[model samples]
Target: MRIIEPVEITPALAVMEAFLVQPSAEPLVVQVGQAFQVASLLTNVPEADHPVWLSTKSYAVGDVVMLEHRNYEALVANTNKNPAGVGADPPNWLDLGPTNRWRMFDDKIGTQTTNPESIELTIAPGRAVDSLAFFGLDAASIYVRVVDPYQGIVYESSVSPVSTDGINDWYDYFFTPVEVNEDFVLLGVPAGSYGSIEINIAKPGGTARVGALILGKAAVLGEALYGTSVGITDYSRKDRDDFGNVVIVERGYSKRAEFDVIVQTSQVSQVQRLLSKYRAKPLVWIGEASYQSTILYGYYKEFNLVISGPTASDCSISVEGLI
Candidate 1:
């Protein structure tokens, strides 16, 4: 579900009174002088239809009250008739409701296989997978068997045996890095051949009923190979008495190419002094040969720099700015 931010509305005191009378489909609705019980799976009790209300002075006859679902507390209602707590039940707890179940299907053809078929899983390599379990609903005991093309019999389990007590929920087949020797390899299957997971019934009277065959992968290792490192340099060209040196600004690791750098200076004069030195006649060299004699000038006050080139590995920059 998508989350949306609420729009801000401004209304005058007289207009607010008229706006308060409108009914809303929000979770809470308010009515003046009338008491209502908050409706929820737990608080509404056995019937699940009780309405909960809060008293408000400005509330009109049909005005709606919106209560944030997270803020309200569930408690037994107090009344003048039952003030002594004589027949009052314990406060009902709030219920958050059920989560949606995952859905799966075969490729248009309703065919379930048991023989060794190559299954191509788009999974992170070397990660442990736990949700890759197989089951079938039949009046017989069944087991799920899997064979990896590169690594044979990566997973086989008879623990989730079928029973008469309806189709069992998808059981998790836990596999650590040790179970699957190699990293998960995605292989292409031939036109007729495909990766197979089998559901074999052990005995009669038990039927093989299959739900969606589900598989999920999670990273086990804290770090992966897909990451990058950056090196930065800051040259201090302030005085002729001092030697120019580069200062490392930031050091971080990312799995992508982009990065950021921040330069902090005591005064703007330091930057100007550095730029003036670079603008002087300088000898540009590529490899061991002097390519050109030119002056490099620093343009902008703030440098929003991006470095990209094919031969970046062999490139280096040296400036004779004031130290």
Candidate 2:
């Protein structure tokens, strides 16, 4: 949430000399909003009182650097006033200022439970991915776990801790990707553990500004030919050989200026029904050209049909006759 402005480097001898004067022997910690300079281009000036001209290099806008401060106890006391007293049930302390502070509790805290609604994912299959990436903002740490259908954990990542400073809105967290040889897989983690992905203005530190945790599946496109089409008049399976040969033929014509011609199985309706049950969208294509002449197509191959569309539509697709 801290907006840091960048500093321009200029060759000013007087300005450079003033910066070389160290504050104290104790190192000062450059925290979230603090600023400091690094030593660069040191030169010897024999005539000058301070013979060394230490070029000061400012910290980058979003750089998170640790300062070596010896007086940490004193600094913490000054910065974080009203330090909580020691003991399981310590006495209430009075706040002296409006500065934000945190207390270390002795009691063990319970891990928060996350609902399914708090999880988001991008599905990618067939890609060479060693890990998964999660993005969020203002989080102490992130925890990841893969669960099976029986509510059993398959894999889990160590609580990856990240500093909250310099992380403005959202950042990416990567985890090892899981391999799936089956039909389906479930991957999830608590939203808080992954940094809140919700968007809100009022809750600045409330992990609500984090956007959707994009669950991407690293996948590669296979040899499978997937597409949608329309405008078919007749489609049926033909005769069978000694072993029963199932031949399919489709015939249709488009009179519109723009029409699409698709060769699919007659079970397109069934495919659409299954997709609807899962609240998915069925793939459909629009006609692109006008065909006054009738076209006929045949397929002697075997394939499957997968209809993907909106849950409200009644349509299906046949994988056969498509290849």
Candidate 3:
């Protein structure tokens, strides 16, 4: 297993342009065929368009407002009640998490940041980073490039993940349904002096959507052995009415996996420390890089490690993805 500890990207870290959209009271929607580039997204890097909370203005129930980097909805019609937990008699606002513009970095794979045609952005992480992991992608192609101020473009690669690539027979090609890869990783990214990472996303006809973008240094935990189990946790509701009719409410689902790996006893302490640090935090858990089912972006539910010999140990972990 390999884990990627992500680095949070703030407005100051973005060297080319701020990674925020212009804050407006009204909703801003990117039209079809519109280009979302870095030059157009440099203004007001910290705020969203949910209309900032005003102390003097009266708000009704269900009214949403943006405070700090998160969004909150009014639970009761009131004024002068701060969403930041100030002047709150009974907590009139409910936290809604990060705004739409910053949803890609929110670490939730269910929420997506979408754009028409393509979405491009550039950022400088300051420190050296060796890996990038993408989850919940809805695009045709992905282009990644790293640039250094003095060394220029150091590394560049493009990937197109589709199910059609494995179709070898004519019957399967004509009958099988086509699906795009939702999770991908670009490993072994060379670190440069003050490197700026650029990511370009493109879709064939619909909008380009990305759930999360993780940039960090990858640490190898252990070698994932065979017989790893993979499954999914579905959130859909199913019920039967009194009349014996079936009722179903479709909802999102998450991937899960059970990994059996062999780790060196010498590195057991380091592995335990790393897992304990990210116990509550979500990180990219890669079992086998070549298999899509082994790549999970979520938290571990349970793990157990036992010493089998002096030099080697066996470890078992169960991970559950975010819904």
Q: Roughly what TM-score does model 1 have, to 2 decimal places?
A: 0.18
Off by over 4 Å in 2: 1-131, 161-209, 220-323
The CA lDDT of each predicted structure is: 0.24, 0.23, 0.79
Look at candidate 3 and tell me the lDDT of residue 215.
84
By TM-score, who's the top model here? 3
What is the C-alpha local distance difference test score of candidate 1? 0.24
> Which of candidates 1 and 3 reaches a greater lDDT?
3
Q: Which lDDT tens digits does candidate 2 get at residues 1-323?
A: 00011111112211222123234523433234322333211122112211121124232222222211000111211222222334223322222221110000101011111222222211211121222332222233344444321234445554322322233443422333322111111123321111112111122233311211222222211112223332333334466678777765644321111112222334456433533442321111111101111111112122233434333222222211111
TM-score preference between candidates 1 and 2, better one: 1
Q: For candidate 3, which ten residues in a row score worst on lDDT?
A: 35-44
List ranges where model 3 is wrong by over 4 Å: 10-48, 87-91
Please, what is the TM-score per model? 0.18, 0.17, 0.81
